[model samples]
Target: MLRRWISTLLLGLAAAALAGCSSTRLVDGQVESFSTLTALPAPATYRIERLPSQQTPAFEPIAALAERALARVGLQRDDAAPRLLVQIGVQASSVPRHGPSAPYAFYGPPWAFGGWYGRPPGVFGGWYGPPPWAFGGWGMGGPTPLYRRAVSLVLRDAQTQAVVYETSAVHENVWVSDPAVYGVLFDAALNGFPAPPHGRRQLRLPLPPPAP
Candidate 1:
């Protein structure tokens, strides 16, 4: 009886570990842009404009987070005669899950997880991209509902009003409310900045812990 109990305990512990490993929140999506420029002009001041579609009060905090991210990419906020205008938008929607294919697979092409090009090879090291069917696989498992939360950042020339750069980050999960997750998304959105990676790719960022 004692031996059987020990085996059961070990099994429980292993199961819990696997659950923790698989429960990670993954942000996966393609970033498409029209510009071939490799980087944004240096030392440019920007102003944030919230679209009418994002009029909710909850967006105030997310906007602040986006500002911080923009700063990280060397863009500053200048309301007075700003050189660049940044339009921020966010949306959340319920997507139908079909078959056993993972959610990420459904959203991106098969080569999304293959490899990274454009910049250098080692710049994205130490970070793990999405796994095969990590989100949810089609036909392999029953239909599991998932929510997609996406944020977009668009940079335009303040004077010309011509869009210079735009990118978006998308995440899939059962439910997401943590603000830090948005930070990760914004970072991914601005990964390549004015010059983004060519073609469709799966940009992976570490999931932030839930807010207390």
Candidate 2:
């Protein structure tokens, strides 16, 4: 029993050590930008188009949030090259934190320590005995959850028919269970893009200093 107790204690300590690594975060920031809105006539009404071939569930909420954001930025929605073309594309998925075949174990007190059978004084006056029934076995344990997501949104110029700017935002430490959060994040990302004038003239968005 005493032996089992020691074993169980060690196992528990190990498990606690592992639990320290577990972490979670909701709605990491987003990324976004637009073409030179200043060059084009101020858009009054605009059209929001769903990106071609995107089937993920995160799309709708992102679309709704983007529409509100564009409206706030003074661009209207239009489909037939009226002014600006707003398009939304998204991808969401999870990757396991642990390897596929990770091992798991059970832990409990030793049978002799306080478990099933206690060691009464042995023949030579030594204490020895089998573990108690209450003592548990190893190899029995529960599973844990790990989830993550990668999402992207893009804005283009309708008349020029070119991607004025595109943004790819990642929410690393989240389960992405709620779509509303995606929309909220989309709004926040839209705010991150500065006014068109601040964008890169050729590629737009502050040019990264020449790659070292």
lDDT string, candidate 2, 98-209, tens digits: 5556433212211001111242211111112211111221213322223333334555556677776565544433133334434445554455453433322222122112
Model 2: CA > 4 A from native: 1-26, 30-41, 52-62, 99-145, 194-212
Taking all chains together, each candidate's TM-score versus the true structure is: 0.65, 0.48
lDDT value for candidate 2?
A: 0.43
Each candidate: what lDDT?
A: 0.63, 0.43
After TM-score superposition, what is the CA distance of residue 111 in candidate 2 from its true location, in Å?
A: 56
Q: Per-residue error at 143 for model 2, in Å? A: 7.0
44 in model 2: Cα distance from truth in Å? 4.7
TM-score of candidate 1 against the unseen true structure = 0.65
